[model samples]
Target: MPVFGIFVPPTIKRLRTSLYRDALPFSKNLRLKRRSDVDPMGREVSSEDSQRYCNVPNLIISGPPGCGKTTSVWALARDMLGVQIKDACLELNASDERGIDVVRDKIKQFAARKVTLPLGRHKIVILDEADSMTDGAQQALRRIMEVYSSTTRFAFACNQSDKIIEPLQSRCAIVRYGKLTDKEMLSRLLYVCSEEKVEYNNDGLEAILFTAQGDMRQALNNLQCTVAGYGKLSKEAVYKVCDEPHPEKLREMFELCVHGEVFQAFEIMNDLYRLGYSVDDLMSSMFKIVKQIDLPEAIRLEFIMEIGKCHALVLQGLATRVQLAGLVGRLCQTQSRLASD
Candidate 1:
């Protein structure tokens, strides 16, 4: 029978061997190509020395969504743990089964088994979205982790590490992943386009990055969506796929706000609402514009404060239209006061 929806052991073992042989070398080769003095967590690990510490540890990989936390874990498992070693791996999403029973039953059952691999290797249990687990569940998990430390290694992936119990945090090697830079995201997108043989414009790729805001996975997905919808990638095509307001429109809106054109700003806000942008989306776009524009520091600070208030209202369940209108009105008032002063 399947172990908590995981594949049957024999079938998984068979598939793992072939996949490990074929895919493991790719990661190994990629690592060899880079002469990085630091590992992914920003720790200094000489290329030669890194190879010596290839053994996987009980790790907690934390980062924003689409930032490659989970990807790094799989790479470590494949590259460091050897072929067919994943058969001894168990992947769980703590968000899906957050009850203490899962920790007491499913996790305990999986971790209790000895490694099927040779010596100097370990069984890996990857608990994704681990921050979502209840405190009670986390407490149970902490004890289980101690009990299985010798036989099973745990890799916890989460967007926020603070939500994970402190005891659990102390037991693992924490690896922090940051948002990908635009240059890094663009390079990866170009690689994908080349491999898929999809033609793309440079400006179109930049547009995708702007929409993704440092999310590598989101950038790639946006690229694919644009290509699928338009049969190629262009700036206009990407904007259409994302359904985001044109940069010119955003510029005009900000200009109106700065010039104290309250009515015009409200009109633009309404139009954006009609165009299917949510209040949160509008606020996010406005904040981005605020950072880029050349404005008096005082005015910029005031704008940010207003945006924060609007966001707080949004969180309190105020109507989107009301909050946005109030934000635009407040911006106009601030501009008027600054001008009069």
Candidate 2:
């Protein structure tokens, strides 16, 4: 198996120079490129991605879901092709079909065919969610790569490369990626807001990033949802749409449960539901509240145990409306009971 690492060929260096400088014989006017192709400040390739602009064609991009792995690589391909990317590159989602034959067919087309201009400079295949491919599919891919080394360049995008077969791992240069940093996310968000000309409050961008958990797609989607509801955007609107209710709201619900207000507690739970708070969200917040107070270990243990039971019931499909309501009531009651004691 060939070792996996970036080896920038001399040809790529010359080509890169020619594309950027006007003095170069092949250099053309840069005014024709679309704004979307550049970054927020109009640099050609994103600074973070320029390190990856070297000559290594077969590449593996690993990162968590929604970190913009798919988008970044496609952008690189688009820049390389010097045209709108349509058929010159193919993106395959491994989880959708989960069959090796499907991958084989696509690989055949990507490797064997020659795409005309206005598509790309060279043919590229982006295997999105590549880690989801079955062992059979991966084995088939290994065979395919051996057959077509020059014409087809494969880029595998996955959250974890450890899940990929070693043989397949050895065949490509791996680019490990982490979640978008706060600055990077903000940069991307500001770009979006500026382009759409959406009116935004000072904290609105922070609110989007906080709730997105480092996923660009999540942030983008939340931004869209906020815009849809508020017409223009504001921090409060984002908080509301994201269901990032005030801490007081959670405390109120906790208080209702603690006082043995089973019916009222149930009502609060309904409100949370209407507000789109998921079960995970409710449990996570409840856990945080329990952690804040210095409660006795034994008592806290008991509460944790009960909460775990309720969580399992909810997840196991055994929970009824009454049962879930009762669980919430118990959790709220437990917290208040601890406070009093």
Candidate 3:
């Protein structure tokens, strides 16, 4: 059962629209820019310049991890968009030293060195994590991208488009993706559950979703692992399998905080810390759980803000049970003030 064939993200339509826009007039525009030093080519061009001249503008798809950027790219290239992937595409990860060199050599060479292709086809080099390259490497890209504009196009996949240098960013058509909605994720999870014929309660599914945080790969992996170890999926089994703090306990902790029961909440927090979970795991899990806790909207926002601050501090290397206790104390204090008001 191959599922890749049917994979279409919610953003695929938008992607196709950006990717398939009319070819800009490359030669005519370059000819105009040629008289002045407007572009790297004697081609006077604005980074925001429009075209069908050299080729389609290179593509940059930005999104969070595991949101199907990779799948979407492959699907568009090999399945839906009729790209001859074997010949016309070169895929490389641009997150490490190897990528930098490739950016300098392989990508540059691939772009300049021409290959025969069907009419209207251009060679494509996909640079995953294009933003991770050093500033110097990216500067190199500015020239390489321009010089080879007529023969090849580069597709960049990055978690943050802002990290991409502006000149490169402007010459590219950008497509952004967001996390999958719970409804969308649940639908896919249900399909997986049915196809796998795994026994799972509703709570079991929810636990998977909670742990996955909208990542399909993580959700599927959690689902598979839960089934493999426990024989059936339950909320408890999922928590055990993922080794994440149980949401039930976290809910109880938050409930106590809302009731202004600081001592009891702190006790639960202490017990969780003693259970061998890292300080980061504790704060992160609580942060996620706090959002789902039934609380007054104002209280919810305050709680989130406080938890965010604690998480930030923890990330800066001050992780400790004392920090967690202090965060709990403040959360409880917030609830107390709300009650008094």
lDDT per residue, candidate 3, 195-224, as tens digits?
567899999999988999977678878887
TM-score of every candidate relative to the true structure = 0.78, 0.62, 0.76
Which candidate order results from sorting by lDDT in descending order? 1, 3, 2
lDDT of 2 at 25: 19
- Among residues 3 or more apart in sequence or in different chains, the pairs in candidate 1 whose N, CA or C atoms overlap within 3 Å are none
lDDT tens digits by residue: candidate 2, 1-341: 23797777889978887666634211122221432553442222234443344443577878887665676676677666655367677788888966977867877767777666432245678888999999998998887787876556788889999988999889887777777777877877777777667788768887787677677777888888898789877778887887765444666765665556767767877777667666656666566555444556755675677778877776777544565576776765675667778
Error of 3 at 15 (Å): 37
Writing each residue's lDDT as its tens digit, candidate 1 over 240-260 gives 898887665777877898888
Candidate 1 local distance difference test against the native: 0.77
In angstroms, the error of model 3 at 89 is: 1.0
Worst lDDT run of 10 residues, candidate 2, spans 23-32
Please give the RMSD of candidate 3 to the true structure.
13.0
